[model samples]
Target: MPQQYGTGMSHTYSTTSSSQPPMGTGTGKKHDGYPTYRPIGTGGTVGTIPNSMTESSKPVYKPTVTYAQTSRATVEPKSSSSPGQMYSKTRSGPSSKPTHTGDCKTPGGLPGLSKTQQILLSDTRADAINNVLTKNEHFKFSFGNKRTGGPGKGGEVVPANRKTFPALTGTGLGMAVVFLGPCGFNTPHVHPRAAELGIVTEGTIVSSMIPENGVNVHNADGTAPREILNTLHQYDATIFFQGAVHSQFNPGCGNATFVAALSAEDFGTGQVAQELFGARNNAAVADVFGDAIDGADVDKLRGAISNNVALGVEQCLKRCNINKRK
Candidate 1:
């Protein structure tokens, strides 16, 4: 009969009778007169066998195993549908150019302007030109039909003030056309609000300005700041920095004419001598001029300054024995 040895009935083997020797006993004996079975090449039975054995028993067998050499490769999980892909963060070339923020459409490539500011600027510019045009005929008559008037005709100024000129309101700019008489002057004064720029159209003039500090100090070479002397002639131009004492004189025997412009619409003038000497009382005046200038002399000087007449002209005429020419 055949007998079971392990948990599964999948495999079976036959041995000898119950009185015969067990499997792997190796006693060189047969069991129940049956031949003993041993594993090939090992010279031994795999396990002990039951005494009751039969010719139907069968032995379990194992399959041979083999190993082959292979190379290892790393792989990353796929972020997209495609697998084993690669990427880089490095740039291919230099950085791009910077962007411009200024308003290129505006004149002078100026910065961005508010809508109100742009509208006001356009309106004022047209208005300023129109105002001059409206007064063109009147000025033409005053100028004797010439672009520039001649001497003996004297000079007149047309000022653009916010109160008098509606075009100047909120414009932040003002202008004046001046025609000076022979030996005339604009006087020593300062603009309270803005600097002044003037261009001479005809004749010659001596432009003088003492800084507000009143120091006529000079360089080691005797040259002063800006220049030692500011003398302008026809087609010449000059700028008087803000708040500095300045004046223009018609040094030529003929009349002089110039065009002047200010940055502010409401630019006002304060004559230096009148503002200092004439506006203050006697004691305050004495403190500034010192006791050397008599109180009576101070009063006389104040009156002279208020009058704005050029000094030393009469003396020059008398010394030169030449008759005065108006």
Candidate 2:
């Protein structure tokens, strides 16, 4: 039998076992059926284990982890569209002319009315001239064969010529005359209802408006019969009130013309100065002149009609309702 340790066998045995060594022993090992105990040495089993672990100790290499190099691009934003460029493209080129619409028609590339309408409008003037010629043929003349006769030839009255201008038939609004004569005198007179405006067209003219009585003032005491207002060579104009006795005399040697526009239709055609102031009605003359006039002076003044001084006073007084005697 092989040496049995615990069982009975034929071998020499010690009383102490290596497997069950004492507590303070240095090292131990297993032999046949027994453990041998020994002191630890420099070349023992603990130092020799490095040689057995040689397979895991060799250098192990791992491929380094790397990312490929990449580039990022920077982008810019765009600007907004302009209004001017947008309008020009829509409205203003040779290819983009505005189309005429509605009632207006376009002809020959021009706007507004056509040529035929223009010709019809021009023919209207000729029609107006023909109408005036037809009306002139119907007028009849009564004072035939003679030129100037009627009331104008005799000094008693001056008849208006109808051929030059028609007689005023409407309101009492009078006629006007633009006198182009040389510098001279105009006879003194009164228009019953008409006011007169005398504008000096040429040389200087002296004009005066005097009241009924010869003296503008009655006496130094200031109780005057009437007032006299006169003006000389006034470049502008002079106005004579209705029923005011007035006269105009050109004082310059050069030719003078005046435009006299009156308010009455007939310039006192029926009112005669001779009939109103004759001596046969001396009482009427005295009523206007008071004690200032004698009967002989009235006759002398009336006889001086040739000198255009039949009415002695240069101007006439403006009519008024106020009685100065009161």
Worst 10 residues of 1 by lDDT: 65-74
For residues 1-326, write the lDDT of model 1, one tens digit per residue.
Answer: 11222322211122232122333343333444445444322224445555675634633322221121212221222222222222112222453543434553333234665433343454355543453224544222222333333221234455665544544557688776666665544545678898889999888766766554546556777854442246688889988888877766565556677778898978887756556665445664433222121111223333433222234323322443435432
Backbone Cα, N, C clashes tallied per candidate: 7, 9
lDDT of each candidate versus the true structure: 0.48, 0.36
Give a tens-digit lDDT track for model 2, residues 131-191.
2223553233222223232221101112222222232222345444323122234434567
Summing lDDT over every window of 10 consecutive residues in candidate 2, give the lowest-scoring window. Answer: 83-92
After superposing candidate 2 on the true structure, give the runs of residues whose Cα lies further than 4 Å from its correct spot: 1-164, 178-183, 211-222, 232-235, 269-273, 276-326
